[model samples]
Structures are given as structure tokens and as C-alpha cells.
Target: MSAFDDNPFAESAGVNPFNDPAVTQVTNSTVESVDQYNPFPATNLASQTTPASSSPYQPAVLQPSSEPTPQATATAAQANLLRQQEELERKAAELDRREQELQGRSSTGKENNWPPLPKSFPIKPCFYQDFSEEIPTEYQRVCKMMYYLWMFNCVTLFLNMLACLAYFTTSSTYGVDFGLSILWLILFAPCSFLCWYRPVYKAFKTDSSFSFFFFFFVFFCQVVIFIIQAVGIPRWGNSGWIAAFSVIKLSKAVCAIMFIVAILFTICAVMSIILLKMVHGMYRRTGASFHKAQQEFSQGIFTNKTFQSAAAGAASSAAQGAFQANN
Candidate 1:
């Protein structure tokens, strides 16, 4: 064998594949292309060489200077609790301030000449409800419900008038019923409002014994009126179920109207009964009594502006008469 053919690898080509010029050229080109695409040219490995210990990517383990003692932990908890306590105190103070504002408004209603209407408005707001908002939280809902009952009563009374007027086309006796209903509406509308509703409102507002007693007494009468109206006795202004069904054959339309009116009256009666029970339960808890009411009445009378003026005049006159008698 010849000297070149003595080695097996030298048979085809006497060159190493890894050390070939083409392979070295391709590797050098790939590295240059990667360097061209790098965004941070100044931070390239060729420009800056850093030791592994001083590298930018370092995994640091933070160690606290000292362990927390029990005293330190307790102090931290106490500080947090104190912050929470201060927050609660701030909230309670805000609530108290709001309560004081409400009570101040209640006491100064007469002083403020209440309803505080806007002077800019051309027309006055209806039915100046000065004391309505002063009702206690417990009774506010029930009081409004009672007012709705009154409205219902008024509507039913009006419908009863129409029904009775219609029934009059068949007979003359129903005319009396219609007239009485008109009178009943006229009297009860204002009287009931002044008697029970206003008193209950004021009772809750001022916690006045007189107002409580007055409400209980007048509302008792109101409850009786409701019962009587619901009964629909003959000659009564109310067109109750009995009276409506009794006159059904005469006029179906009138009967239907009367039936609706009767149902409303019945509902009013049932509601009145329920409300009376609830109100009485509340009143008993208020510690109101007849004696307390009398005292409040006397105090209220003595505090009246007219009564005070008359009392001053009487005292002045008595002093003058005594001076003349001494002279």
C-alpha cells in the first residue's frame, strides 16, 4: 500500500469534517448575525466580561437582623387594636352628631316656623306636615300605614256616596244615606286627623305623655267607628257588605260599587284593629300614664304664649289693686 492509503480515513479525503473552512465560515456568520440583532450592543459579551460571582443575575437570601421577641409582637398587636378602637370612636361620634341634629330640629320646629318652605317656589307645598318627620323610628312605618288607612277611608267614603246616589234612582231612602256620608266625610276627615293622627305623631316626636294618652283615647273611638262602619247597619253612612248585598237585586252596578266600598271599609277596620294593638304595645313601653298626661297638659297650658300674656296682665292688675288698697 502507498503511504497515503495506509490510514483508512485518508482514503476518501485527507481533511477533518469539524475543522473544514466551510463549517468554520458558517459558524462565524451565524455568530455575527446574532450579534447584529442584539438590542443592547454596549452590553454584549465582547464589550463587557463579568466574573460569575459579580453577574447581574444573583439569587439573594435576605436575613433579618434579629428575631421578633414576644414583647415586640404584643406591641404590634396593641397598636393595631388601638387603631381599630380609634376608628370605632370616630364612627360613634359621627352618629351622635347626627342624632343631636335631629333632636335639635324636633325641639325648634315652632321656633323655626316650620316646614321651611323655599321662598323661590311660586306655589306653597300642600298640607304642611311639620311633625311628620319627627316620628320615632319604631313607629314611623305604622304611622304612615295609619295615614294610608285614612286615605283609604276617604276614598271609600266618596265611592259610597256615588253608590248611594246611584241606589237613589231605585228608592228614596238611600238619599238619606248619601247625605249622612257627606257629613261623615266632612266631620271625620279633619277631626280624626287632629285627634288621633297628630297626637300619635307628636307622642313619638316629643315622647309627650299627653299626646300618647290623647292618641290612645281617640284611637279607641276610631277603632269603634271602624267596627261600626264595617258592620253596615241600616241608616248608617257606610255601605257595608250586608247593606251592599241587601240592595244587589235593585242595581248590579251600584251593588258592585258598594261591595268595593264595603271591602275597603272592612280592610280599614281590620288594619285599624291591628295597628291599635301594636300602638298600645308601644305606648305601654313608653311609661305614659294619665297622671303624667295631666302634668304635661298643665305644663303645656302654662307655657302657651296667650296664657302667659294673660297671666302677666292678671299679676299686674293684682299688684296695682294691692298698691291702691295699701295707700
Candidate 2:
């Protein structure tokens, strides 16, 4: 009655995909002949009435398709990705190593270019250096010298006052002679104060020809004053309590000692001038013009003296005569 009742494997695909074989046919009479000689007997239906046919409704199992090929494709792609990543990492590592090598070579090249200083580097004249842009140290030195010079001058001045007092006391000089003495005091006191102060102040403010000019001018006056104070100026009442004062002046020895001190300070002042000239000459050789030369004359000395002397000499004949003529 049913189509499957005749053939059991009608809907199933054939064993081969390309070609199907003919189904084998078995007649009912042949089935009965095979059944008549069966060795096992069927169960009684009355005893199994509570259950349906024991055969499961599950479909027949199909042959498993080959799957190893797809799995191999996926595994191959995964392996290739990992290998590419490792190759990239290796290239990065190589690049890093090359960079380190280049850095090492660069440092080594620098050492080779500028060799290390020997343990015993000989001392050469410092005048032959390359000082392009700097403040001159001579300015500082001169300023300090000026300070000490002023202090020493002031000390002598104070001693001069004490000597004057002694002379007045010994000679009974009519109550300290404040008339002409006051005039001298008023004139010299203010003038000397400005001589040192004005120049030093200008030394800090301006770096021009006028500044140097004023400095030299005022300092020359101070030197002249020192000379006058040293040898002894007659009728100037500069004798103090020393030789020019009363014969029996108090503490004449002490006044003489003060005079010696004035001489020492004058020597120091002379030394300061000599050194100032040398520093100025050295500074001018660096191709600096008047303004710059004046500025750096005390501060920077970045050149060889021979060239400096030539350049400075060429600028001013008097300067050259003073500095190079000594050579």
C-alpha cells in the first residue's frame, strides 16, 4: 500500500555521487521461503500489546564527509599570521641594534676628534685666547683697586688730620687755624670725593669712549695728588706733624709712618695703571672698536697679545707708544 513498503532505501542517495546502481528486488514468495525455516520464533502480540514496534523512528546514518582539508586550511592561515608577526618583531629588534651601534660609533668619533687633555698641559700666555663675547675682569680688578686706593687715601687723610692737630697743639697755632684750613678742607674734600666716586659710578653705567676718557682723566689727577702728598709740598701746610711742622711736635714718628703708607699706596696705584693698560691692549685685539673695546678692556681677554697689541696700537698712536713701544 505504501511506497516504502515496497523498497526500504528509496529516498536515500546512492553510494556513488556520479552513478547509482540498480536496487536488488526480493519477491514476497522468496521472503516467505526464507521465513519458514527461521530458527527463532516471533513473540506473541498479546504479551506485547502495551508497546509499539521496537524499531526506532530515527533516520539512517549518513557517511561522514571528509573534513581534514578545511581544518588544514585554517591551521595554515593561523601559522602564517604568527610567523609574519615574529618576522616583524625580528626586524624591529635588528633596527634597534643598528641604532645602538650608530650611537656608539658617534660617541667614539667625538672622542677621537677632540682628544683628552694630557695630565701635563703646559701653561701658555692667557692673552692668546678666543674671547668674543664676555665681560672684562679688569673692570672688577680696577674697581677693587679703586676701593682699596680710596680707603688708603682716606686713612692717610685721617692721619693728616691727627698730625695737623698735633702741630696745632705743639706750635700753639691759634685755635686750629680753621680759616685757610677750612677753605682747603672744603675744596679738596669734595673734589677728591668726586674724583674716585664719579669715575667708579660711570665705570658701571656706560661702556663708551667718554667713560674711559673720564676714568683716565680723573685717575691721573689722583696720581698727581699722590705725588704731591709723597715728596712733601712746602707752604701747603702738608707737613702735618712731620718735618714741616713744629720741631717738638707730638708723635712725629707716627706721622712719618703715615707718610710711608702714602708712598706704598702710590706704588699700588701705579701698578694698577700698568695692568689696566695691558688688559686694555689685550681686549682691543679682538677686533673690537672704541665702544666695545672700552667695555671689554677690563672684562674679556680672548685673543693673542701680538695681534692685540698691533690692533690697539693702530687705533691710538699714544696707546701703541705706551704698550707696544715697550716691546
Backbone clash count, each prediction separately: 0, 9
Off by over 4 Å in 1: 1-133, 314-327
Write one digit per residue (lDDT tens) for candidate 1, span 1-327. Answer: 687757665534446676778887888674557447867666567657767887678888898769789999999999999999999779767655655554454444423333357867665433334434566777788778777777787787777777767767668977788888888888887788778877877787778889888888898998888878777776787788887888889888888888888888888889888988887888889898889999989966875558889999999999999999999
Q: Judged by TM-score, which candidate is best?
A: 1
Per-residue lDDT of 49 in model 1? 70
lDDT of candidate 1? 0.77
Question: By TM-score, how accurate is candidate 2?
Answer: 0.37
lDDT per residue for candidate 2 within 1-327, as digits (tens), equals: 876576665555545443433323433234567447766558676885754456567567998877778889999999999999999779767755644543343433322111234536664221111112223554555555555565556665555555445445554552343233344445665565566544544443344444555666676776666665554443344433233433334556645644554455456457546645743563354343566645665533424345568878777888767887788
Q: What is the C-alpha RMSD of each candidate to the true structure, in Å?
A: 24.4, 28.3
* lDDT, residue 212, model 1: 86
